[model samples]
Target: MPIKTPSELFIHDLSDTYSAEKQMTRSLPRLARAATDPQLAQAFEDHLEETRAQVERIEEIAEALGLKLKRIKCEGMAGLVEETLSMVDQVQEGPVLDAALIGSAQKAEHYEIASYTSLILMAMKLGYAPAVPLLQATLAEEQATDKRLGAMAEASAIEQAEATS
Candidate 1:
């Protein structure tokens, strides 16, 4: 459907994010398995649960707003997940790979952060008061995940990778 109004645009973006969250649910397990660092592996596992909840939150918003989320593929997230998974093949399975995974995960987190931020703003502007809290909750989770990943990278992953080099 052609987006001729702000509400339509909001739905488009929301649907895109829904697709992104679904993609992550599938990709995160691989990431968790590939992570050599215990903390990193656990982080991926934890985020997988969060991503599941986030998907449900989006669905709740859709139901509350009486909008059906489009079954569109979010190409942006597809590319991000592809790149993230490819890191396993590109790098050796160790500290270097762990570091690479952090990088990849952060890229996805940043994408989600931006997407959620825009969605929140759109929700507010479109008078989607019901969606604001749900979007904000997901946004908070994404931001926290990014921060945890960054801390892990700084505290160990990057340093370990460098030590191996």
Candidate 2:
């Protein structure tokens, strides 16, 4: 699709995020199972629920905007997930893998945060008032997830990984 209007761009971004969240729904459980740290595993599991909600919110936004969800593949997130999957296979089940998992999770969260932030700003600029709050909520959740991963890394994963090495 050629870049034409802000609305067009917004819809594209919306679809992209929707696809990303849907991808996470499948990937998160695997990540959770791969984690050796109890807290980290739980965090991934909790975020899977949040990811589902985010997917629904994006769909709601599409309905509110009178736009159908585009079937756009989020290649960026696919690449990220692939990288994480490779790490899971390469690393032994231990704190090192847990740390790598946190790093991978944080990278995905950061991508989401950036995407949602951009979408919220665009929605506001385009006067899509209804989308603003929905996107904002997801953005906040992504940020919180990132922070939780950071805390997990700082509190245990990183130190344990280093100690074992």
Give a tens-digit lDDT track for model 1, residues 46-95: 99999999999999999999999999999999999998878898899999
In candidate 2, stretches whose alpha carbon ends up further than 4 angstroms from where it belongs are none
Mind giving the per-residue lDDT tens digits that candidate 2 earns over 1-165?
596888888888889999999999999999999998889999999999999999999989989989887898999999999999999999989999999999999999999999999999999999989999999999999999999999999899988999999
Give me the runs in candidate 1 sitting further than 4 Å from their true place.
none
> Candidate 1: TM-score?
0.99
C-alpha positional error of residue 131 in candidate 1 after TM-score superposition, expressed in Å = 0.6
Highest lDDT: give the candidate number.
1
**Candidate 1 worst ten-residue window by lDDT:** 1-10
What is the alpha-carbon lDDT of model 1 when measured against the actual structure?
Answer: 0.95
